[model samples]
Target: MRPALFASLLLILVSAPMTADCPCIPLTHVWVVKTCNDWNCASTELAVANGDPQVIAVPVGMNDSRWLVVRRFTAGAAVDVNDDSFQLKQFDGMDGAVKHYSGMTRDYHPMLMTAPDGQVLVLSTKQPEPRGRAVAH
Candidate 1:
């Protein structure tokens, strides 16, 4: 019944991270989204919502290229991400991971990293760690 206790509970609930990437996120609808090549791309505020991650349009020849991949995670598949989830989750960037073609399976794409939480992290050809080419120091 205390006001302070109620306030503290509210703060904790507000700060919690939502499981948006689960059940494998989706692509934003056509026309409203942007890609890595656009010079006047929309800012974070005007960008797609968490429920709309579908790649509406990609850069020229970007789809088949091994350099970039935009996608959502699958249910129960943890993204297998870490504190660096920022770079991996960015909507556009060149520092992405390098998907190892040799490591890919017949059923799945080369970049899909399925974690236990149903998070499928679609890394690029420049991702760090097992995906990156550089030896970690």
Candidate 2:
């Protein structure tokens, strides 16, 4: 094949929007709380309605405990909230009458907690529609 043809094909492949093989349930909201001490605490919330990428900074301190609250979560979905160092555990609604790990089955809200670590928290999801794509001039 000619160089020009090969280059064109490569560009098309590179610029095309990538899609996931299986459908994913979108996350509506996420709340992160960090308790540094008895009185000092910090929290951040991310609303993922538009499927845009979100990020939050974890303050530097000896975090006594950390909690994460997520809404619109589904079982067996490709959802993840983690830093490079550690990943948060996933809980599916509830188990029987007893609530497990602060998870509520009524609204699909699950709470997750982890050890004190990580610098930044990043959240991203693949929306049903294709994201922005590049067009060659």
Candidate 3:
């Protein structure tokens, strides 16, 4: 190959984005579950721009991870929540766990609460399936 053409090809190869071995799941929003004391509770369909930072007690011996519910926008507008799906994600330091919905329903809602020690507890009407192998990029 010509020197100039070879250099150009090398540059292209070097700059090209590396793709994952497996298909990546796009993660856009994160929802931290919180407990409600009364009849009023914050709306669940909140966007990324609004994050609730109210500190709650974490459970005993739960010194590491934070529980989160994640959502991906597969349709509609950027902030719209129509026809979207929710997944469970847990983060403990550098490692994390995720649970995907094999079949999600609108009635299945989840809430998060923290123990006095800062350990998070995930509560939901419907139990999530086994931890998922799928990962978000």
Q: Is candidate 2 or candidate 3 better by TM-score?
A: 3
- Candidate 1, residue 99: CA error in Å? 10
In each prediction, how many residue pairs overlap at the backbone (N, C-alpha, C within less than 3 A)? Answer: 29, 0, 8
Candidate 3 structure quality by residue, lDDT tens digits, 1-137: 69999999988887665542546766433333332222122233333326534332222122223323333333332443323233333333221122222233324544344433333434344334354488889
- Please give the RMSD of candidate 2 to the true structure: 21.3
TM-score of each: 0.19, 0.19, 0.20
Instruction: State the C-alpha lDDT per candidate.
Output: 0.37, 0.35, 0.37
Candidate 3 versus the native: TM-score? 0.20
- Candidate 3, pairs of clashing residues: 33-112, 57-114, 57-115, 58-115, 58-117, 58-118, 58-119, 59-119
Candidate 3, poorest ten consecutive residues by summed lDDT: 93-102
State model 2's lDDT. 0.35
